[model samples]
Target: MSKLILLFGGLLIACLSLSANAAPLNPLLAPLSALTAKDIAIIANDADPMSLQIADYYQHRRGVPADQMIHIRFNPKTKVLSRLEFAVQKKRVDEKTPAHVQAFVLSWMQPYRVDCMSITTAFATGFDEAFCAKGCELTRKSPYFNSISSLPFRDYGLRPTMMLAGNSFEDVKALIDRGIAADFSQPKGSAYLLKTADKARSSRAVFFPKIAEGFKGVWPVFYMEKEFIKGQDDVMFYFTGLTQVPYINENRYPPGAIADHLTSAGGVLSGSKQMNILDWLKAGATASYGAVVEPCNFPPKFPHPGVLMANYLRGSSLIEAYWKSVGMPGQGVFVGEPLARPFAYPSK
Candidate 1:
């Protein structure tokens, strides 16, 4: 009996080692505790009251160091910035940022696009005219994707940026609180990857099977075809393509849920029939992404559901996981509380 027990224990150990080796390296598994308040830099437009308020609230809530707060004076209502204006503003931000800062939080909605590149991408890789020369071609890849380093800029020379944006200050505050609540909770939830009849938007459908296999046992993965998901609770992640409003009102997403719809103008803050990404936040999602400019239904320009789920399940922050999922993000604006990490520490 003693010999049998020993053999069984040895086999268990061997199996566990094999499983660990087979699993892909998830950078999000690295704890945010590894990052200090000093590693984040918050930017606000001095002329925008909402920007100032959001920046202040995020700084206080995240415990970011006071020295890391950088302010600039720019047209707060403009949706696009000229090359020269963007260059000057980027220079100002770069100068004010401390060398140790690893991530950036832009507290504004307008000026989401700089020339042809999204403001987030410009800040991460610096503006490249080549990226804008072709509207449909693949843009540069991010160095921070699948990276193990928590200090992205220090390790990979790339600073991941997220906009603390919404329709109003009150909304932004609520979003921030939700992110704070998600830390280390590891709540039970599901990831819904939907396939619609629209072929251009349905490109992600090919990845659904792989996602289900990859995330099996980690979370319930649901794959739907030509059908809408509704009235679900504890929705941890959702991705789909739709031109108009989705059936989000029918669902109840928990605090850390990451949801987004792939539509051309989802990033447009106002006056569009397409659902705004901010509506996801309003509907209880903690983070979301959308294209500020026309991306022509390119899957690479948007967040890949498989990549996002894989990283998030491994405990990556919302911003990090979402950012890594996009192979070309020059046209998309990422919105959400950047530090929401529900799976960072497994729940007891």
Candidate 2:
């Protein structure tokens, strides 16, 4: 009996040691303490690679606590109280394990009532309906709803399948008629996007002034860089809805003269820096685009050499097309034609 007791004590020590060596889940949440709100905003708006970089940055800096983990026990009755207490197990349950530290950081939000939406499940392969519906709900409930009236968020819930294939304002109007929060006002009434006057209608800028005008206050929402600035029609959405910092680019060039120019014009310039997407992913929160690709700068595919040169000269790190698919704060992807610049990366 004494020998058996000794053996159990040895096992407990081993378990504790193993738990100490495990990795963390939310590595980026910690280091974020050092980052300014402007920096966080920058990374949050950048594509998926940069968003992940922000996540990783906090992970390494803050790490996870052993108490916030998953564990297992066989006592014939796995009670909820025991399960929550023994959540941090020493052994890894899955090879594709979340970094031990990450789990702790993610769990931290639970205590604060800040629920991190399950984007993976939301955008899962068979959950298309849920995806569209959730997107609509979020847009409606979010404080920034008024800014994105031109977006087809309302149609997603009513015609989930149709939305998967892309949609138009007419399609959404039908959904709006069916009571899907479709009331939109631009410049208080009409003639915002549909303005006949060339000057009122002209200007290759979207999102910034338009959304700012629409919301009448700054409300954070998904933001794109180059695309928002190139199309004069794009700016109309802002005028009709709630958007904040309309001039702020999601992915921006370094803090310098170029950034000032883009902001003033309600445009963004990407590819000005030589940042590696993967490294940015590792950083957890602070990432940026390079300098050259401003709004209306990079044309659709097969852009002229002059366009490419312009991008190169600006020192922008043009994100590879595929990397920009996953958007953040929410997983909103642009299904438009080839002209659409890289979209946002979803926050995991």
Question: Judged by TM-score, which candidate is best?
Answer: 1
Candidate 2 yields a Cα-based lDDT of 0.19
lDDT at 115 for candidate 1?
83
Pairs in clash, predicted candidate 1: none
Question: What would the per-residue lDDT of candidate 1 be over residues 1-348, giving only the tens digit for each residue?
Answer: 122122222222222111112223332233333343567789999999999999988988989988999999988989888889988988999999999888888999888888887888888777876445365665665655544556778777888888888888999999999999988887888888888877777766766766665555446888888557878886888888887645787898888898888888888765477888989998889988888778887677778776676566566788888876776777888989888887777435
RMSD score of candidate 1 (Å)? 6.3
Worst 10 residues of 1 by lDDT: 11-20
lDDT of 2 by residue, 137-216 (tens): 32112111111111112322210000101022332222212111111111111112211122322222232333223222
lDDT of each: 0.75, 0.19
How does model 2 score by TM-score?
0.20
Backbone clash total for model 1 is: 0
Q: In model 1, where do residues sit more than 4 Å from their true spots? A: 1-36, 346-348
Q: Count the backbone clashes (under 3 Å) in each candidate.
A: 0, 64
